[model samples]
Target chain A: DTAVSQTPKYLVTQMGNDKSIKCEQNLGHDTMYWYKQDSKKFLKIMFSYNNKELIINETVPNRFSPKSPDKAHLNLHINSLELGDSAVYFCASSRGVRSYEQYFGPGTRLTVT
Target chain B: AQSVTQPDIHITVSEGASLELRCNYSYGATPYLFWYVQSPGQGLQLLLKYFSGDTLVQGIKGFEAEFKRSQSSFNLRKPSVHWSDAAEYFCAVGPGSDMRFGAGTRLTVKP
Candidate 1:
């Protein structure tokens, strides 16, 4: 069983299209996060959810939104996708807010044409 | 602001040779340190973490890290490197909110 899993490991879409990446964590973690890794492999946190509540929101564009249905799921929805949004999106989860050990999924390689 | 620096962007070592990856962090307090390895086309795997107590912590896959408080460094070490050890290594340090990761060091294996 995967601890943290993201659907559609690879996404290919045209610009201006709207797409969503789903994520689920089997581990009973209270904190989940979304991270974006650019082509250069520079990973940065986009958003974080603690117990289904928005906690950390990095300086990201408004086009990207994160929704956590429950403590085990944190999905990312992108509106009006841009070429710059073509990157590997990763979903991660930790035991709690204070926990530093984060388990990441395989990652979703999104390609915007 | 907290930050992590991995000076060497890349490193090459022959099989069975010793390996060490340097990591330096800038933080106001005693930061939580971690070392992760990412294989090609895969997610990051936690090698080890140093929260408190022991300065030298052992991890899975025969990896270890030494936490030096004065130098603000947590360098990863392996006595004998394997060919499969060639991967991207990252160093991170943080707590409370988020962990800041280094640029990552790509390790290559030489025959």
Candidate 2:
């Protein structure tokens, strides 16, 4: 079984187009996260949700909003996407907010023209 | 603020040779350290982690790492390299919800 899964393995859209990526985890984890990997392969944490509640919000712009309908699902919606938004976004989950290990899903590569 | 650094951006090795990847971290308190590997077109996979206790921790796929608090370092090593092991390796530090990852080191194996 795929512990963590993400939708739209690849996305290509215009700079002004909006898009959303969905993520789900069957690990029964209470904490979920969204991470952005840039062209340089530098991974940065964008947001974290624990049991559907926002726990950590990094310096990401307001255009990127994460919503967790339930503890098992967390989705990311980008508004007014810019060219700089092109990167691989990965979804991860941990047993808890303080868990040391995180299981990651196959990343979604986003390319904005 | 906490941060992780992987000094080597890329490392190449022979299939049967030994391997070592260095990682350094800066945190105010005792840190939770981890080593993750990402194959081409794949997500990150946890190779090993260190929270406390033994400084030397063994992980899956013949991977191991040693945590040195004095040096603020956690480096991953293997006795021998496999062609399948060629990938990007990342070192991360976290004690809470926020985890910081290194820039990652790309491992290339030569047969």
Q: Per-candidate RMSD vs. true structure? A: 0.8, 0.7
For A1-113, candidate 2 gives per-residue lDDT tens digits of 89999999999999899899999999999999999999999999999999899999999999999999999999999999999999999999999878459999999999999
DockQ for model 1? 0.68
**C-alpha positional error of residue B62 in candidate 1 after TM-score superposition, expressed in Å:** 0.5
Best by DockQ: 2
Worst 10 residues of 1 chain A by lDDT: A92-101
Residue A66 alpha-carbon offset, candidate 2, angstroms: 0.5
True contacts kept of each: 0.52, 0.80
Per-residue lDDT tens digits for candidate 2, residues B42-109, read 99999999999999999999999999999999999999999999999999999648899999999999
Q: Clashes in each model (backbone N, CA, C under 3 Å)?
A: 0, 0
Q: What is the per-residue lDDT of model 1 for residues B1-111, given as tens digits with 9 covering 90 to 100?
A: 789999999999999999999999998888899999999999999999999998999999999999999999999999999999999999998773588889999999998
Name the runs in model 1 displaced over 4 angstroms: none
Taking the candidates in order, what DockQ does each have? 0.68, 0.82
Model 2 chain B poorest 10 in a row by lDDT: B91-100
Candidate 2: Cα lDDT at A11: 99
